[model samples]
Target: MPDSAPPPEFGEASHEPTEALEPSAADLSRTRTEEAVPHTAIIVPILARGVTLGVTTFFRSRRDEAFDEDDLRLAEELVARAAVCLDNARRYTRERAAALVLQRSLLPHGVPPQEAVEAASFYRPADELSGLGGDWFDVIPLSGARVALVVGEVLGHGIEAAATMGQLRTAVRTLADLDLSPEELLAHLDDLVIQVTQEGHEADPGGVSGPGAVGASCLYAVYDPVGLRCELASAGHLAPAVVTPDGTVAFPDLPPGPALGLGGLPFESVDLPLEEGSVLAFYTDGLIAAPGAGKEGLRRALTERELPLDQLCRRIVDELAPSRPYTDDAALLMVRTRRLAASHVAAWDLPADPAVVARARLMAARQLGTWGLEELAFTTELVVSELVTNAIRHAAGPIRLRLILERTLICEVFDASSTSPHLRHARTTDEGGRGLFLISQFTRRWGTRYTAEGKVIWAEQPLDPDDTPARTSGD
Candidate 1:
């Protein structure tokens, strides 16, 4: 018999005998015992598509009837249907596992320490049956003693959603490096989402097409320790909960911009001045939408701001979302605001004259000496001279030179002109256009940021030369 075929009855003839032999006494006794115990068994292979997953065996005994052809056919049909269901479940399990791994790998494993805020984060994926949802959060350090906090969510679930989440997270970081304001960053992100949707539609014209194909929401906030203020903008995301040092909880009303991928909507940013040690809780909607926890519950959870940031994050999640499987993914980032010490920051107003550049250098050298960074004076002075000279020559009005002492030494030159400086490679005969270039080479990193009064050209120098490697001017 074939592997898929049922076994024949015991003591049944393999073929019809040409001449039947008379039954002996022992054979007759055996037949009588077999007849006394009437039993039958049928085996059916569980086949899905063209492959057999397993076999099901049905046994019947002590009955006048046995399993016939009709019974075997019914058994095979039932097992085949069950096998298809099992295969689908298996495929789903595999896909979910892959998506979870991809999502976790893409998320930040650790947040580095920065001067602006002490931050901690939490992320939990959705339940097994629901698969993983695309919810992510990050703390990115920016130039000039500032930090960017981000929390975003992509609609839908599975591997595609996780991939989209990673893409958005990376784009946010890249945009943050340019020192864009929160509103400006979201607007750029909106354009990117629209472009991605258009490309996706082109790839699959017959498939479902719309903003829903790439619909997402995000909240980007920049915290400036020097200014002691935070500028926040949202793309159809929830407002963060603010908890003061005195345990007062308040949610700042933010302009709810349209969700990403929807074109032609402008995003506005709100600048909030926070007191020292105030706690800002940034989270996705899943945290508040959990069972038994809503906006009120989130407020209640945030009351215990006295706890350490890491502990506070855990406490809030435990109180609201918990460790149990949720229908949606949840993410939380809690940061305590801090102020840059007055002693660490030094600024001076300089007249737009070549003579003032020497005084500016002297002031910076003296400040570095006071801060015990004398080793970096030579490079600092050169950077200061180049930035100030450029500002004096090209920019209008009085110039302001500011130096901030943190993990790195930051030199900033502010002017009333909005035109940003460009770094150009000068020929052997050229005299000008080398100021910004030389600044870029001498400093660890340098960039320009626009201010309301004008524009500020800033450069960062490493505090310890031996520990930090210098990068090329292109960097």
Candidate 2:
């Protein structure tokens, strides 16, 4: 108990000293003993979003010169307080890691080098007890004709929230891959969260590392290549902001539902017009939710119609912050839409000639290439080939292929025949029935919509900036 007795090794819990992170007994002894043991001190760093908030530490020591049962008890009690600190620090670390990883791994590294349109982004982690809050935003290029945009948040903060955010994100990516409808994907994710929570799954969710859990609020949309329209869905998240051609910010009215994991049905995706020279901003609530953000703050700072997207992001991060770096997590995503060099069109025809098809191919390629949209071109051609062929062969009268790119490549074959194309499994040797099959195989998404001007068949594929080796059914 005498100060003369050499300080012990760094034990597991206490500074009792087993193996200090330091070197040797001589060095340990050489170090000031007062520096070694003192009263006790505990520190907690607030983590919000994914950034460090501030550190909170407490100091205490053995009442007696040496830690006795009562002193140990005090240490334990101190630990209880420190637990809050440690837990917060650990949460901040994990959440910060999760957010940074997600931000880097999930978001498009940067706009395509030579894109026709300009794009940029900004990120800020919440500063809080454990910046593990779950706000997230992401963008994925879909088939050359379209791109997928997402913004969402898992409930709560810490490892659980990050994990949940990751899970929902994965679900979005997977469902997007499956080419399922946005509505279907939301439903699927809802089911998944419930299943994981009530039961649990091996798959990790959001930023959480281990078997995943938690739930989220999400919005996923597809931006078309040609028309540049957006098809979006809301799941207990804030309504999106659209900066129009004339500098008008429009916020869609989102319907009601609990955030994911609270338990319920999936929210459906809705379609919106995405015009040229337009900017759309999607963000988690943390960006807009201060104690008094209300709608006015968002309208003025983050979602003002005339504001540039980069400016919007900066403003959101600047204004409306709680005391902590994250108090809760936060995320922001923005995109600017540019018009094609020239409008792409299906020329009127007297006959369904090979020349027409050639023209269509040339049109699609030129627009895609000029727009720096290599990803949607190949599939667009493939789709054009299938639809035009179908129009010429199966239906009578003038066949027209008009491209209405929103969420999918809507290929309309204005055939006299009112017959709808059906998706079917093909036989190995069969060539004729393979038209729709090829479209199905090549694209991540596909479907049809009946318009006044005949029927349209559409498909979606992962938008790629480069023509990397494509994945097959097996891949």
Candidate 3:
């Protein structure tokens, strides 16, 4: 097309003049100017899946020859390929954002405060290209002044892995509430994963299942401040690192049970006796997998155990995986062990006789006086009396009474039988069923926990009456 020709209007047709008209002087001047700088342009629509994303305009100026059919075909082909790439990029960005949001929302915002372990955590998502993986960590406060620490990782990345991580984390918390042993908790988690895998296979027989469809690894550890011990079990996870108060680091040889979803192997728990102020480090494999990071580097990072856990967590990440946008998701949880002083705990074995209930109450009252908690002696004595009488009446074998003085006073009664106790509303005429009800009215919270030897019925009473209004009972 000649540069002198006028551009056609959109949705308008061009018609040839019936007769030629002489050009005006102004028109002749315009034509001469246009001829001096000749230009042509072609526009091609960028299409993906038969939908036009946009248009690419190719312009040629001062060209001796105009664009031909071959040029148009080449432009169309190039734009078609570019369109597909752009569409893919757009889709990936959306999915990556959604996955990140889901993962963050599902993870714990902050670790809850507890008496057993002082903990801090760190989490880093994978680089954009790799997407996010299923790495998670949590610190759960268990009954009997204990705490459970968990670290887990699913096999793949993106939304599927994140969803799997959330499910497994929830399962761990539920099992922790039951106060299951580390080995028992892992066994239950393994069964859960196997069930999920079977369901996924049944749903999609031909295609690969979800990110964790094959398997995942986890470490579950429970720390008892009273016992000064940590019981830990792993499901194909790396062993945890323990740094003693004297600055010695060691990774205990933990039995590596089969990963979750692999059903036959038995999980075993190892009891690690930890000293007061010892630092325990739990992390996913990504920390060591990073470049220039390994067990030695981690040990070096953890040597200064006196530093606050929050700062120490950052230091570990900076030393191990300093660069941003990690290739894989990384999680770290560190806890400093704390021991309950022996002076705050009192325990005694009582014979299973109705006559001993009064003696048990007297023992608890005297312990309260020794702890200078005489104001709480009245309620504490009542709690001890009712729990002892119930155990003596309903359960079998020897009964033991224990009083623990902390922020609140804890009274516990242990009996050999595993039969759980139930809280009942006693009718006015009933004399026997009123003991548990009276105990509940006198305590802030109460629950039962089963140990290897027997079950313990524990009640917590507020040390200060003013603190009662701010607290909620967990009966």
The candidate that achieves the highest lDDT relative to the unseen native structure? 1
**Per-model TM-score on C-alpha atoms:** 0.81, 0.58, 0.77
Candidate 3 residue lDDT tens string, 46-67: 6677666777777654444556
Between 1 and 2, whose lDDT is larger?
1
What is the descending TM-score order?
1, 3, 2
Global Cα lDDT for candidate 3: 0.80
| lDDT of the candidates, in the order given | 0.82, 0.60, 0.80
When summed lDDT is taken over every stretch of 10 residues in candidate 3, the lowest stretch is 11-20
What is the alpha-carbon lDDT of model 1 when measured against the actual structure? 0.82
lDDT (10s digit) by residue, model 2, range 294-412: 45676666445456667767777667654464555657777787654334433344367766777777776776675466667877888787778777777667776565443333444
Candidate 2: deviation at residue 242, Å? 2.9
- Winner by TM-score: 1
Error of 3 at 311 (Å): 2.2
Model 3 bad stretches (over 4 Å): 1-97, 128-131, 203-207, 211-214, 323-327, 369-378, 424-430, 437-445, 462-475
